[model samples]
Target: MFKALVVEKNEADGKTSAAVQELSEDQLPEAEVTVAVEYSTVNYKDGLCIGPGGGLVRKYPHVPGIDFAGTVETSADDRYKPGDKVVLTGWRVGEAHWGGYAQKARVKADWLVPLPDGLDTRQAMAVGTAGFTAMLAVMALEDHGLTTGHGPVLVTGAAGGVGSVAVAILAALGHEVAGVTGRPETEDYLKGLGASRIVPREEIAETVKRPLESETWAGCVDAVGGPMLARVLGQMKYGSSVAAVGLAGGADLPATVIPFLLRGVNLLGIDSVMQPYDNRVRAWKRIAEVLPMDKLDSMVHPATLEDLPQLGRDILKGQVKGRVVVDLNG
Candidate 1:
């Protein structure tokens, strides 16, 4: 038997509770690949899955971990075999299906990617789904004609997982990175991650009034998609792009199309889940080559299976910082 964090619902009260339980391999859902999960990570979606359904969880008695890295223990597919290391991020594993909050996980082979060279299972989990999405955002921005020396590339929700990695990667690529964060205490943290300037959240959190602020940011990787995103849309430089990754603030977009019509601003929607396999491979390989390992190390905070419950609660409250790497064997 192996250990897994299981969430069960109290049907009468319509409430949920999570606990670590010993489970057998037979309990796992049928899939082509069975991974000996070494490490996983906490994400915002995980917070919802660990507590309430958030419309993401399809059923009860579920496991909640959006991403993990490990060695393949068994595989029915020709593409993967025993002893090969792999990584998984999207495809709703922790929601509609069994996930990586356990010592082992069985998943569709198509959802797995070979772990990039120079990254161990633990290091891969350190980069998790959040970091992977951050890389996607960066790639989207660059594909739309963003380059260094144009101006600062703003990263909204800068202290969070995606923002942190985006700031580091953009800075590493010789771009001036500005991070927007509400917490003043994280200014130093953001700067340490290669951010050159720190923009207070309040500076851009308000709804757009002018609909065309002086084209300030050369580009943006936005994880906050409410009014903050609306405001940033007006601030983007002419013909530049803003990659919308997450909706931490809110889902509503309150703004005008003047930025698009007048300044030629491009809003790129970045979807990590359901991404084509070829693009996923390209992003992972780029992450391995571009992201500095030391910066990635600084973003990591270790946790065990037991710690996930509280971590989930903390993440929902927007109190968690950086990345929380969960070691299955810890």
Candidate 2:
């Protein structure tokens, strides 16, 4: 038996509750690879899965960890073997199927990537799905001609997971980074992660008044969609791109097409889930290569399985800071 955080729905009222329960391997969903999960992380999605379904969790009695790092205990696929370290994110594991909120997980071999050479399971979990998406956003921006000498790269929702990692990676890549956060208290924290400037959320969170603001940011890693994204679109430097990673603020994009038409601003949608295997490997490898261990370490706050329910609530409320690494063995 293994310990897993199980969320069960009350059939009568449709309310849900989560608790750590001892579960047998027979309860695990059948798949090609069985992983001895070492560490997982609390994401915004986790908050929803641990509480109400958030339209992401497909069923009750669910294990909600969207990303994990671990060692392969068994594998039916030829690509992986016993003791191989692997990292998993996306592919809807935590939402659509059983996830990594346990001491063990069974998943398709294709959903797994070999842990990058420089990272251990614990550190990889520190990066988690958030950091992985940050790397992909940076790659997309660079592919679209973003460079160090250009104006500062903007990271929206900058104190949150995706924004935090984006700031660190962009700074480490020798670009000036401006982090947008509602919290004034995190200015020091943002600077510690190499953000050169802190843009107050109020400055950019307003709805787009004019379709063209002064072209300020050379590029952007946008986690907050809705009006904030619409505002940022008008602020992007000419011929630059904005990698749209998440919609923490809201899903709607309220803006005109003037930036796209006149300034050549590009809005690149970044989907961490269902990303192809090759790009997943590329993003992880890039993360291992460029993202500083010290910065990543600074962003971590440790937790355990028992702490997930509260952490889940904290994340949904935007009360969680940096990243919360859940130590399964702890």
lDDT values for all models = 0.94, 0.94
User: What is the TM-score of each predicted model, taking all chains together?
Assistant: 0.99, 0.99
User: In candidate 1, residue 167 scores what lDDT?
Assistant: 93
Q: lDDT at 139 for candidate 2?
A: 99
Write the residue-wise lDDT of candidate 1 on 1-330 in tens digits.
999999999999989999999999999999899999999999999999999979999988999898999999999999999999999999999999989999999999999999989888988988999999999999998899988999999999999999989999999999999999999999999999999999999999998569898889999999999999999999988999999999999999998999999999999999998999999999999999999999999999999999999999999999999999999999
Tens digits of per-residue lDDT, candidate 2, 157-186, equal 999999999999999999999999999999
Q: RMSD, each candidate, Å?
A: 0.6, 0.6
Q: Any runs in candidate 2 off by more than 4 Å, and if so which?
A: none
Weakest lDDT window of 10 consecutive positions for candidate 2: 206-215
